[model samples]
Target: MSQARPTFQPVHRTAKMPKAHTEVDPLLDALGGRGRYQLLQYFVSKIYAFTAAFQLLNFVYVARNIPHTCGQPNNISDIFTAIDDDAFTINNSDIFYDKCSIRVVANISGDAETKQLPCLYGYSFDERKELSIISDMGIVCDRAPLKGLGQTLLIVGQGVGAAVLPIFSDRFGRRPVHLISHMIVLALGVGVAFSPTFTVFLVLRLILGLFQQGIVLTDATIGIEVFPTRYRKLVAFLSNIGWCTCHLFLPLVAYLLRDYSWRILQLGCCSVSAVIILQFFFLEESLRWLVANGNPKQIKRLLKKAARISRVDYQHVLDVYDSLHSGHEQLDTKKEQEGTLSKEQADALLTEPVVHTVDDETHSLLDFIKDKRLGLNVAVLWFIWFTDSMTYFGLYFTSDALAGDRFVNVVLLIVVQMPSSVAIYYLVDSIGRKKTCIFLHLITGFGLVGATVVRELMGNTGTGAIISTAFSCFGFFGIFGAFGALFFYTPEIFPTNIRNVGLGTSSAFSRFGGMLGPFAGLLSEYVTWAPGAVFTCCCLAATAMVIVLPETKGKELPQTLSDVKGWYVTTDDKRRMDSIAKDGDADETPGQHGL
Candidate 1:
């Protein structure tokens, strides 16, 4: 048998070299690797934040609590006579309640008994100061409920946008949706100023809320995407400074125009948005989105423009694009080979499929919750968003009801948020996302609790207000810092494919809290401390959840659920990728549409 076996000659072969493959990481390479393009996007995006501040907080003045009481036109001789400070007090409570019914000493059945009656004369608001919708329509007594209603509607609209618009941004494109929404906000905003009645104003405000929320979220999300990973916190901090600037500037606008109508204030705020139109000239569509959608032509044009402005070599962008295309083609070829051959044959050929990327799957809100770790993280982030919103709006709304000159005190409360951005610039990076969240939420909680205690100890005295304001200062700083860090962290944690959904969903939860804030303020009717205590507990609860959250400090931004779970690529895939990235030369026009 051995002799019968044919002698096999060793085949002499030429030693031909295998082609080296090349791969390009878009977020790490391409235009983002350069600083100037990232900064340009940041500059364009942050400007929207400034204008947005005016639209968001204009309600502070629009439905503000002016000095209003039941009109006394019939009782001419004693317009304000013997109007006991406690005339409108309810249920033997020590708190003053003058917004609704008026007290009248009457003679029923020849016996004198004080009875509460509807304000027949219509409430007369203070004419010595700024006018509002409440002033014009006399929104008092039976309409006292309407004041809080308007604010709630505005917040509800934003919640609706959060639930809906991200889907549009995902399906259509961020640029068109963002621009269109901004235009809607601007047009409706001006209409809010010229609104002839409270009904009209409320309707206009709802529409304005719908679009303005989209503008801010999309603009900020685009900024987060285009920036270098290392500087995400810094970009967020700077973007939010516009909010602080608006706070400072709004007080000055309020103080200067104390005698003006609310309409004028609304118009003034809407005008700032006109500057945003200039974005059409310079702002580039998100390159990440462009590539994902498989529009390399657009990507090439935008990247070349960005490269020119950023002083990067345009040839380098072309090289990167071509290289990525080649690698993809090579991967495709290997996939075909693997599909056709047996496992042993495939191993002899040395090939496997590529790891899944974000664009491979269809993204939706469900993706955030369907995955276990992501679901838990999303739930925790949702609670944090809810608590953050409740406390922030609670304080901003409550500041108006403080003992001192409300306008002046509101300005002071806003002044406190100014330094928070500066602190977050360092805090987020130094201590990491989880630690920063815990520390900030804890500080905010303790600050609120401190405020409640101070008010109780010192009563309504000016001294108590000062002490409480100090506590509020700490609270605002902590909450604002938390916001900046959360904005940066939330986007980084999610993959690009569903980032808009993740952020929008989180914001929707925040709006739910905001929608509840006005209702929560109603708790003060039962007991003044109830609202503060509830939100403070919420903040502390956020702290507890945050402590258990995973840290995302200086890590490569996760582009998929597997990446979030810290999975590594198989050895074969890794080696193939390396070779493809190094040696592959791609056709310039690979006609594949991205997700």
Candidate 2:
């Protein structure tokens, strides 16, 4: 007879304590036996890395299309213009018609100005003379309006998607929703590459925006739920790094394709999207979701496949599963007398009032507004997102606006963030999320205010402008910490069940600020220093609001609406949690997070 195959024993869903109950470990248990489980852990890590890469592609593509150069594009120096002759340098002074001219006051050679000859660029007599006046001023802009429309559509789509994501995550499952959303964006991105006219391209970009919204929110939702609590900060740090990398990639693309058409930029983005789409096969359904669905066998198979891919030995994983199994048994035994909700009933409780664990709908937007606790948290976060986004985009765009080689300056500005991102990784959890957020917001506000003051007081000379921009950039650097902390903090504010809905709603609201941030930069040109002051005020207001919010530094994740509504209510005080496990039927699916 063949040697007996080694038996496979799956771990249990809930953790057990010898004397009482403990938390569930479905996710840890799902890894199954050791050899296979270790492999699965490695596979999950790659999936996360792939997600970051995909998000980075979006930021890089945006920076490329919207050139950071000070003036607009013109036929003479625009992307389409080419070298007429290698021997002769461009000097169109003799061919000028007043308006379409660049005066060469003196010939500057070897850092010395000589009155040898003055040259002009452009022509006097031509069929395009009238059009040339506007064109020669570098007047016929392409990227601004298109970029604004695209950004707006994206924000609107984000709002809509955030509104519906709770329902979607529940109905479709996290991984499928994430993959399908990315595929939608991939298809629309190709449309962006091939768009013949500006009008059609704008429409396609809007649709693409909608898909982008779902992809991020869903992916974030999954990332928060799947990772153990100890590892959540790692997700935030990695996401920030990915975001900062996009800035660096922008300058690289700008430098490489400075003379290339915008279509080439879109094509590059599409290529990245295509690669991300291919990685979807490796993406796994959140193990947390599997427990909620009561599919232990499926979880086992999923972990086994991960083990094969990750190349880890099986025994180590088996040991973890056994520990979790024993823990769950203890938990269930203790709960036998206390009671528990049936799985189907638990699922329905998610949207129900009062059930908290992934199933509680503790508060809606309306409820949040009415309840002081929920209302204050929502208000504070909304402003945090708004201020963080505005300052972040403003600094990046302003760096582009200042006089310098857009590529190098943009790249260096992004490079400064490498240290900032690393810093966020170490401090986010150590300092406590609330403290980190407050500290960064206050620093960012002061820095922006200081930069604006320096610019107004010193005037716009090269040295002064550069100095001001440095302060502005530094101030913006602090905003990254504020932003990274917010993602982790926001989802924790609300109870588990409606956590996705609350975050999605808030993110959608917050993204409106992102939509406005670009336009705010545009407005800065006409309004002078007003935008800076307005931003400073917004940051101050946001900081004040944040200071007043509660600290969740050491609190365990709440499991039910009762947890939120009755945080003070306890059976030890002699009143049971009213045993919602049956009558209230709180959903136990597990909470989801959104970005």
lDDT of 2: 0.54
**Per-residue lDDT for 430-514 in model 2, tens only?**
8877777777777787777777777788865677777777777667678767776777677766654455666677677666777
TM-score computed on alpha carbons, candidate 1: 0.79
lDDT of 1 by residue, 285-367 (tens): 77666655667788788878888777877888787676665565665665456545543564544433342223344555576
Q: Which regions of candidate 2 deviate over 4 angstroms?
A: 1-147, 257-259, 303-371, 399-403, 522-527, 554-559, 563-595
Alpha-carbon lDDT, every model? 0.68, 0.54
Local error of candidate 2 at 500, Å? 3.3
Worst 10 residues of 1 by lDDT: 586-595
Show how many residue pairs clash in every candidate, following the order shown: 13, 33
The estimated TM-scores of all candidates read 0.79, 0.68
Identify the runs in model 1 with alpha carbons over 4 angstroms from their true place.
1-34, 68-125, 128-130, 333-359, 399-403, 457-464, 560-562, 565-595
Error of 1 at 505 (Å): 0.8
